[model samples]
Target: MAEASANIGVNFPPFLNSSSPTFLPSRTLKPEFPLTSKLKPNTWRTKPLNLTAFAPSSRLTSAAFTQTDDGKFQPRIEADNSRTGRVFFLDVNPLCYQGSKPSLRNFGRWVSIFFEEVSHSDPVIAVFDGEGGSEHRRLLLPSYKAHRIKFTRPPSSKRFTKGNFRTSYQVIRDALRSCNVPVVRVEGHEADDVIATLVEQVLQRGVRVVVASPDKDFKQLISEDIQLVMPLPELNRWSFYTLRHYLAQYNCDPCSDLSLRCIMGDEVDGVPGIQHVAPGFGRKTALKLLKKHGSLENLLSAAAIRTVGKPYAQDALTKYAEYLRTNYKVLALRRDVDVQFQDEWLVERDRRNDSTILSKFVENNDRNLLVQPSKQV
Candidate 1:
């Protein structure tokens, strides 16, 4: 549809031709909230990004390259005084609350610790998806995230009402501002896009980044110098994610995460998909089809080939081709999303107890707190 996989010339058996029996998906799990809006198919207007390279700085502290017990790389926090500085692109939603369902008011202390744990002495640019975050995606597919807006967040305790999550979010924001951590909320974009756009900005300066969020969508941004930190409320810890770790867990390269999501669709996002395929079946089927044909275009092309027996992938690749293409446009990330890259955004400011950075941010009237002693600060 919108994008094709690199492997398009896959060899197919001679038996494949136009007269084959097309397979059809038999069932799809009923959505919690049924789609009310009509699904319209259209090519996206936003331009796709042609990313040249993502080579972040090679400089590091002695412990920057530490590995887990399994020998996978772990992102390390660095000293501002270190040769290479580190900044955390902390997704504000995680610090928002555990679920739309209500939770405790412990968001402040927990977020402070989380910022400290991930950013160390380095600065954290907290990002929040504005209230209309999914607006553009809805333009792509009317059904995009139709299920989420209807549900009310449940408060964990009586003291914290379901409606108080926003209040909690504000409390966390003030707490962060007081801590000298600069936070951003682009009025009409999702936090993920803001994070992506900002990641490109920092990577351009050869600075390493740690995206602190549990959202799996950020996996597409992983690389040698960029890593993901997931909040683990159950264990009261955080899980680190890397490209190597993603491959080890999903059996496919991290680059294919978007493609896989396009084929199967995501219930969380309310993206429509093939019916009859069981929950988790989409991933297995998509992985198989991708492995065999290399890309979605090829997989769809191969679906057109006539086979002696019925093919199970008929509906999604053949009949549903238009749907897949439309979803890809919505699923793909836009790195060129016209966000202003402020110079101070790339500067990692310190958050010492003296409130020096906080005072600097307010006094300078710069959303991005300047960190340098001799110049800006």
Candidate 2:
């Protein structure tokens, strides 16, 4: 599951995109700005940027949800404030939740564990997939993410009723809103594009950002001010996938990984790979090929060599070189897409100092909202 939880503070307007940068944050001159920055860098040659570990050391106070007129569960702001230099670009997808039809209580727990890892001063802006997830991508490839809409196994009768599944996701969104986190969406864009836009936009203001999704597409967005955070909900641990993490894990850079993706294709997104041609055209072989020939363009240009490993489809790759070009567009994240931002969305909410009451947010908020309606008769 590649999708999951993440959002920020903002008073959203009726209109989405802004003509002028009304929400742009103030910037300060920094001495450490990378000079060799390019739109697309040769990632294989570049060294990894030094980034702060994703784990938060200080013990953060947990509080029960304080509801206002609208029934949303927000943390009762009560913790000593400390500065977190990064603003989190959180993605709100259910891929992180376990089992069939995950409940709102599980969502609340996700928020709790995730928030506890960052300082209260670090702002978060959670983005959700809009009406049709990635319409543009679908126009490119009709099968993009179409497979994710339906679960492989039937929904659990004990877990959630027929209609309750959608509601559970809604409750998660409502709970995040209750916390005053800006849960945003553009009419035609998915969270991936919105996150890509924000990651680049914030970096221009010199603020650091960390994207909280395990989607491989985000790997290309990794830079000095931006990183990726992968949550291991099962083990109750979160790992920061920086440039170093990727290099150590994949033996290649994110840009090179993108090139590899074009060759391998993603079954999750419904993109077909050239696996029919080259039996060994998986990750390792692709990386090996990428290393031998600096870029995909170079690889395709040179003579097709017999690759090592299972079912070598050397001729298959030669025949499908053109198809690889078409898949690249589908596999790559659109860094040039349009997205709107709210001013307050960029700033972190100061953690309040009034600490007294303590209760589990899920137990209190979800018992009625989730249980009474979905309980088996």
Candidate 3:
């Protein structure tokens, strides 16, 4: 069930089309101030200008986003003590339905809603799943989420339609863009994978990364600095989870562990954990049993096993082993994704730190309804 490629072609804003007249060629100077005596041959270094060169007002060019730190940049708010946080939101599964629906517009509304709620707090970067993405994972592993696709009734006249799905996706993208949010999408990878890659990159830069998606699968990425934020309609009602708590609650540990998928396979991905076993139950069993016998390989090798559950270990050996093997692959999240950021992705502008700096932008952009709230949520 691959997504149609045409849908992946979400339009992005064009690059700066015309350079300004201020971008002029620097005139060669006859060493008005003697060049450094040990200057390397052929190297033309700009003499340190006066205090004006160091002033915040002098470096107002938009190019600062890409050029600061010599092109290696990460997004940051203005120079302030405020913590830098990157929020990633994902457009999840689509329920196919009939007839034309305004999806893009709806998503735009949601994006507007999201921005209106949190735009004042931190810098946000968003990404969308391209076509043929999450669905492709199933093709790679037959049981990736086999359980969810089970057909309920006999063949009928009705068929799946993607009309509303497409509209919803575009709505989010456009809304985000209308508010100047950076939305990214890459073909052939699910939004989860892209989010993982982005999270990994920024975590190394001492920034707190929060993924704003409802997918439980992203639990695998939870860590000290990398947390999961499930926001609610009531701003203060959001839920935050850490990796340690996740591991303890879920009965599965990603650290120093194998791909056993916590023992129980995920039915959502067609993984059959311990054959007839259920989702959370199978996982709990695998984690507990492995704790006693060591690895799945060792658990199978043991002549006798202890358990508090049904169907003794030996009787379910092959089933459990296979479940562990298959589910591990299914549970594995791809942490490597090629998201090339231009140098501009970093380097905070003076205006970014002040909500007032964006006032003019909000007034001019109809899509942007997020006014700096008179008070914080």
Candidate 4:
């Protein structure tokens, strides 16, 4: 992945790594979307003739100092408006590894590593995979995420059982709290939904959002100001993307949130996208239907057009309707999560100080890492 241009105000004047801190101008003017296609606009919200959202400022606000002035401390807050951009790190499987030695340590390790670097660039927010604490799909469809059910099973040994694993979750939760990061979990909802809720909210507020996760489902969230960063083999290095980038790859416009996603049902999340409708075909059908009936609902129920010979169209309509009702139950992110933004969540690192700050993380005894910190958020 290409790193942000150093001339872009990256803080590398006194750092160890070849990489430079990305100083995103919080005041970047939102880009204008030009109309070039004849696609119907009723089914999907037309790309506003002037589509713009919150753009992250290139600088930090009230950049308080924790290190020395000579750059020995490697300024933690480099950009002018520090808190301008909201960075959210979504943990897909917060408890993916619960059986190994100090299993919960994985969460700690990920958290520390993320903050240690982000603290130097932007204000970061983290949302962990709550083990179903909030309103989840179970209320709508009990079979949702049934595959991961083994995770919730009661452990025979108190130390290894589901209850114990949750206890370990509490440990990881406490560590995040001490760091001042927001840890959220809705009893019945998944972490993805919570993260989505946050992304959607920020996007609406015009604040740029960067969701950190490798899951393909998140691709749907990519927009002008909103982007994605996927971790690569290199520590801390990530692959970034925008909606246009995705359009280039898939050959379909992503501005239409429903048309784009409805056709390409997410298999990972068990969403059987548009029954027999091929991937890009959903986009076409959605556009055509929207042009005729004005909305997915109207298209599905249009009596005169129901006889169209496309089996995929009928199936698509059925699935689309079912999805409309339950997918949000499944896909719409949740903002009402009990999680609250905290200050300590921002991890700070002195680039000029020492490699050991984050280097020590690569190899440490899980036990020494502290399962749960004393503080709570």
lDDT of 1 by residue, 148-182 (tens): 52112333565454554444345445656666566
> What's the lDDT for residue 261 in model 3?
48
Q: List the global CA lDDT of all models.
A: 0.53, 0.53, 0.42, 0.43
lDDT of 2 by residue, 119-196 (tens): 233567877766555667777778777655421223457766676444544555656655656676665667787788
- lDDT score, residue 9, model 1? 12
TM-score of 3: 0.52
Candidate number of the best TM-score? 2
Give candidate 3's whole-model lDDT.
0.42
Tens digits of lDDT, candidate 3, 1-377: 22211111111110010122121111223332332312222222345532111111211222222224443322223442222323334433321111122122223333344444432223456666665555656655755543332112222223323332233344444534444455677777777787777766765543455666556677666544455655343443334454434444544433314434445555545555564654334555666665455455566656234433456545576445555555565566777777753223332111232233234333433332221112100
Give the local distance difference test score of model 4.
0.43
State residue 39's C-alpha deviation in candidate 2, in Å: 25
TM-score: which is higher, 3 or 4?
4
Candidate number that wins on lDDT, 1 or 4? 1
The order of the candidates by TM-score, greatest first, is 2, 1, 4, 3
A best-first ranking of the candidates according to their lDDT comes to 2, 1, 4, 3
Provide TM-scores for the models: 0.62, 0.64, 0.52, 0.55
